[model samples]
Target chain A: MSGAGHHRNAELQARVNRLLDLAESRGVITRGQVDARIEAFGDRVTARNGADMVVRAWNSPEYRERLLADAGAAAAELGHAGGGYSSDIRLHAVANTPTVHHVVVCTLCSCYPLAWLGPPPAWYKSEAYRSRVVRDPRGVLREFGLVLPNSTEVRVWDASAEARYLVVPQRPPGAEELSEDAQRDLVTRDCLIGVAVPRLPAEVSR
Target chain B: MSFAVGDRVRVLTMNPPGHNRAPRYVRGHVGEVVRLVGDGRFPDESAVIGDAARREDIVTVAFAGPELWGPDSHTGDRVHVDLFVSYLEAVGERSDGGRTR
Candidate 1:
């Protein structure tokens, strides 16, 4: 479970361990608490939560309206109350249309929708991604293997405040015939982050 | 509370020594207000004052790539940042006076 194996930042790893040690020695927090929080993030809180919301919205027009209108409330409707972090941290869903695409980022820091979509990927927290995505979104999307058409407007959401964003990608073609669960399978974590779009099962293998 | 959706505004250019959430990339740039994300504890005050810090309204501002990064940026791309009210100032309308504000 430790990142010392291939994390590439031994100095930061040591510092984090030192801080955790200090907190433990001072009785501020027990190791069990830390492990529990990690386990929760690693297991209970995953992208499946966001996929559930996205899947529901795709199936029902009224739910889609509610999701776009008030994402936090709609998330709670599906049991993702988005609790734990500051109550002010609101979850907002931005749906990608045929002409407009949406990507989320936090230039100041990695302010992701952890409560609804689990922790962000490591690349998302890197300085390279943070700084470049805002300035050259199309280029970065290309690096992610997402080549949008010139006419498709890219909307990069820089989550600089407590407002966290969840990108609701439009359901891909050939997926409408699939069941709800199958459709949810197509909505991968990258799709939720907007770095990639959902692909049909057959397209994925190709 | 001061600005609404479609309001043309500019990010105040300042190098305040205090803690601020406004990123350096957005400072001094012009943008249009898009969404009003409800009030929350102002980060500048919260950094020094903690939970008791004064609250302020936060709004999402849409910045075109050209305005932030010049011509090399993709023509159809845009960045939307959620900035506090204190970090923005009214720039009235778009300079072109033709684009939808």
Candidate 2:
């Protein structure tokens, strides 16, 4: 970044630090709690958690059924309970089929399934993406290097409420041949957001 | 629940000057209630009255892409928006906010 931009960011960080100190001293919030939350977001809660659930669903039909029925309960079943600010928040998984593609966005704000998918990409919060995805999802996906066939049905989930969405990308060809760990590696954060799909290394050529 | 799954509902067009959860794009638009997402504290009033605001039902409304963006929207595409119960009414129901809210 430019020197001026770096200086501006440092100034903003110092202001946030002052606010944190004031909040801590006033007993409004504890430093330990703040640290724990940051730690959770940075490490404990991540897209790998979503990948774990997806891999389990791919391996077992019963688990997949359970996930679709009650995604919150299913996440807890896999020990990846959607933990964050509110217990009222619900996670809904939308699976991608050969003829159907499911993408998620919160037009008003970036209400993401962060507990499962980790932090949202910067572009997910951009005005261009937030507005256009709901309008021309297929076109935006094309920009993301995902070109769905004209016949495919695109479903854009606008998470304007408490219900957070997770896109269960279809396991790619040759994915079944890979081990469980290999399969999880394919399900990146983008895959979980429905911007892109998981693919085997060999399939990259297509 | 005021609305059941698969019911055709239309979002109310009333523009409350307070914090409204119903996005402008969906106001006065018609969609199908796909899921009954259990109620939460009503966001609009809660924004003004705080937590004391009554909890109300919310549902997933799936609108056809064409209905939202007209010709620019691709065929066979849809946008599903989660809307509070107060912001919706039965398709033929009068578009009066007082009746629902």
Candidate 3:
């Protein structure tokens, strides 16, 4: 089923590219402008920069406090806050501890924190995920292969309002020995989404 | 529309003709109001034809896993969902009781 879905998606993408080429030739929208727009959009919503903020917070307590208190300003301090549709949207940071974990979903539509995190993955927008995550969070997380202890609370942030949430995952043990750049590399998008925890060197290697 | 931070409220399942952000899983499920997030322009009527939604006061509701799922869920686990005002309907202490918010 997954393979078929990917094949269909690839075919649709080819069709879209063909349409885009025809549109550009017809002078409907310039290819240069479209390229520029895609670039601008990418810069505005890419999650790589947001991961940097999380890494910085992990290394610094002061920044973490600021980020938790006011995520929008904290992101702007790193020159990654405001963008295309972010003028009206606010970002919220939810920290995870040994006792708590955070995940985000949009039940109604695919409302996402595009400013901090780039466009959401296609899986995040799927009706199956969006419907099930809110109803059965643990089941959904388990499907992602994340099995939390019974004592750990799983917090699911619904991105319904103009606000978006970014999960601040707990720093793994032995991370203090690593450099800031190394630490940043461990903080993948899945970690920020609360599906997967940050890995140590051994875990990464395995 | 007006409830304390810890007040338990059930989300209404209204199939109105507009852009609503409430999820199907949470509709009719009771949860505690965790935070009284300030108002913003509502999104339901705005995103229909490309009009930007104005922000409205939205409350963050926290639900225990047992309440949402069943007793088989993790004991101490809870999920926090940010819900708009349109998605909620207040339930009192005398109402049908099952989940502790």
Best by lDDT: 1
Error of 3 at A100 (Å): 0.5
Off by over 4 Å in 3: A1-4, A14-28, A40-45, B48-55, B95-101
Better of 2 and 3 by DockQ: 2
What is the descending lDDT order?
A: 1, 2, 3
What are the runs in model 2 whose C-alpha is more than 4 Å off? A1-11, A27-33, B93-101
TM-score of chain B of each: 0.89, 0.86, 0.79
lDDT of 1 by residue, B7-93 (tens): 888888899999999999988888999999999999999999899999999999999999899889887989999999999988865
> Which of the two, 1 or 3, has more TM-score?
1
Clashing residue pairs in candidate 3 are A45-A118, B38-B57, B39-B56, B39-B57, B40-B55, B40-B56, B40-B57, B41-B54, B41-B55, B41-B56
Give the better candidate number (1 or 2) by DockQ: 1
Residue pairs in collision within model 2: none
Give the best candidate by TM-score: 1
- Which order, best to worst by TM-score? 1, 2, 3
Write down the DockQ of candidate 1.
0.86
Instruction: Write model 2 residue lDDT over B1-101, tens digit each, in one string.
Output: 49999899889899788898898998988889999888888998888898788988889999998787887678699899999998987875556753321
